[model samples]
Target: MALGSKKLRVYVWFTLPALLLYIGFFFYPALMGLNYSLTNWDGMARTYRYIGLSNYAAIFKDERFLHALGFTFKYTLIVVVAKLAIALGLALLLTSRMRFRSFFRSIYFFPAVLSLITIGLIFNEIFFTILPVIGEALGIEPLSRNILGNKDTALYGILIANIWHGVAVPMVIFMAGLSSVPKDLHEAATIDGAGKRQRFFSITLPFLIPMLNVNLVLLIKGGLTVFDSIVAMTDGGPGTSTESIGFLIYRHGMLENKFGYATAESIFVFAMIAIISYVQMKWLNKQEVGQQ
Candidate 1:
């Protein structure tokens, strides 16, 4: 009992600092934000009054906020689907017997090392300058203009930049998942006259589910909280068509100084992410269990 109690004390000593830091930095601020959300403070005001959910009610009625919420959901859906599909595909290709596999993997993963802002700026230039020249040369009407200039196609242009920057980690993750799949199972499946597709569906995919869940949550969060890429590329423009919830929060909170309202929106987003992620995890857990 003495030895075990000493070990527990040592563990607590090691963990206490990090736990306190987390509470100070994250938990405390979150509580403050929640408090602020119930108020009418503009952040610089010397005197502010608690409005008690007025901000939340106003946000629901605000058209721009509604539009941003819708836009973020759409972006999240497209991003999650595209990233998962492409990353899984790339992971499979690289894990297979192919020449210069390491070289291709490195090349594909290189973009992930770059900052989203840098990637956005580079793609911004490509859309603004290089693509137009190529488009004109090819006599393509759509390409002849700046892709980011049109609200209709701006989302896709932003998506192109995001996907390029985002897919690498998921690819690496899926590769790790693929590697853990037992080779002996594949050998057995092959002897049973199972083809590649059958084996993948029956065996490989089951193992990839947990990894898929992880990647899904990650992509969802990234999509929902996307900011820098949009700022660098669009700055919530082509007339607010590409504006996301994160950008809207920044615009209101930092730029417009509507701090209280933005905090309310932030809390709403927090709830949304929590609820969606929880539901997804639950559903995926069922899938995992079913596979077993």
Candidate 2:
């Protein structure tokens, strides 16, 4: 027992370096962000005036900030829903014993491996060109008036590209979840005369709930952080109609030199994410309990 305890102590000592590195890098920076948000600080200023809650107050009063917040939440919600529904359907389809299934899965997952900037550039042409090369050869127009160039349609166009790009993540996760489900359960359901839809709802979907919960949270977080695609595609353009809170905060810190204000905005984004994640986790847990 004495030798075992000594080895355990040595193992704990070995893990300290990793823990210290994580605390120094990630958590320390995050705490500093919270601290800076309470001060009125420019980037290289000699003094940062402590402003208490003024920075937070300004966020509520700024019309542009409010608009950006609203738009960001709306964009996040829309893309998340679209991705979940589409990815779930694709997961179900591809998991079936269908033809050339590996090829189909690769095609679905391919976009996920592409860089965000590359995907944005490729889709930029798709949404802007009156006719793609193949479309022109087939005498079919691919699109009209650059979708990303218009104030009215620019935001919606971004959402479309995001959903298209994000589906593979959930699909892969769901495919894994589906595979882990017991085959005997599905076989028994079929033997008991459960139809396809019934079997899916009763057995498959119930078991998939945990993975769905995880992927849903990831999709929402990814949608909130969307920037590269929006920047490359619309440049927040036509009139800031597609401007997101992430970009708004970015411009504040880098362009306007309002570090404190940007920090406040970032804090707000973090809170929104935390609250949304908490609510979703609670709901998912409830659903899991009810299913069991």
Candidate 3:
């Protein structure tokens, strides 16, 4: 009993600083935001009055807010699917016997190290300058104009940049999962004349479920909270066509000075991320269990 108590004390002593930091940085701000969200603060007013969910009420009725929410969902869906598929494919290819496999893995992972804002800036120039030239040379009508200038195609341009930048980490994750898969099962399956696809489906994919769950949660969170890429690439333009929830919050709070309203929007985003992530994780956990 004494030893267990001593161990607990040591653990608590080590953990206390991190716990305090989390509460100070995250929990405290969240509580304050929730408090201010019920008022009409406007960020600079000396005095404010409690409005009691008026900001939230107005949020649902605001067309711009609604559009931002919808666009965020759409972006998240496309990014999650594309990233997962591309990353998994890359992982499979790299795991196979190939020339300079380690070099290829390093090359593929290089993008994950670059800042999203930097990537967005680079791609912004690509879309604005290079692609238009190529499009004109090739007589391709869509590429002739700047992709970021068209509301209809702006989202796709963002997706292209996002996929290129985001795919590396998930590929590394999938590679880690693939590495853990037992080779004996593949050898045994081959001895029984099982083909590559059959072995992959029966043996390999099951081992990948946990990694899949991890990647899904990561992709979902990233999609929902995306801000830097939009800011750097289009600044939520082609006239608000690619406005995301994160960008909307920043615009309202920092640009428009609607602090209370922006706080309300941020709280909504928090709730949204939590709910969606919970549902997704639950579903994926069931899949993990079923695979077992």
Q: Give the CA lDDT, 0 to 100, for residue 102 in model 1.
A: 92
Residue runs of model 1 more than 4 Å from their true location after superposition: 289-292
lDDT measured at residue 236 in model 2 versus the true structure, 0 to 100: 73
lDDT of each: 0.95, 0.86, 0.94
lDDT at position 284, candidate 1: 88
Worst 10 residues of 2 by lDDT: 136-145
Clash number for every model? 0, 0, 0
Report lDDT (Cα) of residue 268, candidate 1: 96
What are the per-residue Cα lDDT tens digits for candidate 2 across 163-183? 778899899999999998889
The TM-score between candidate 1 and the true structure equals 0.97
**Best model number under TM-score:** 1
Pairs of colliding residues, candidate 3: none
* lDDT string, candidate 3, 1-292, tens digits: 9999999999999999999999999999999999999999989989999999899999999999999999999999999999999999999999999999999999999999999999999999999999889999999998899989989999999999999999998998999999999999899999999998999888898889889989998999999999999999999998999999999999999899899999999999889888988998787777763544
| Candidate 2 regions with alpha-carbon error over 4 angstroms | 130-142, 289-292
lDDT at 124 for candidate 1? 99
- Please give the lDDT score for candidate 2: 0.86
lDDT of 2 at 260: 93
Q: What is the TM-score of each candidate against the true structure?
A: 0.97, 0.92, 0.95
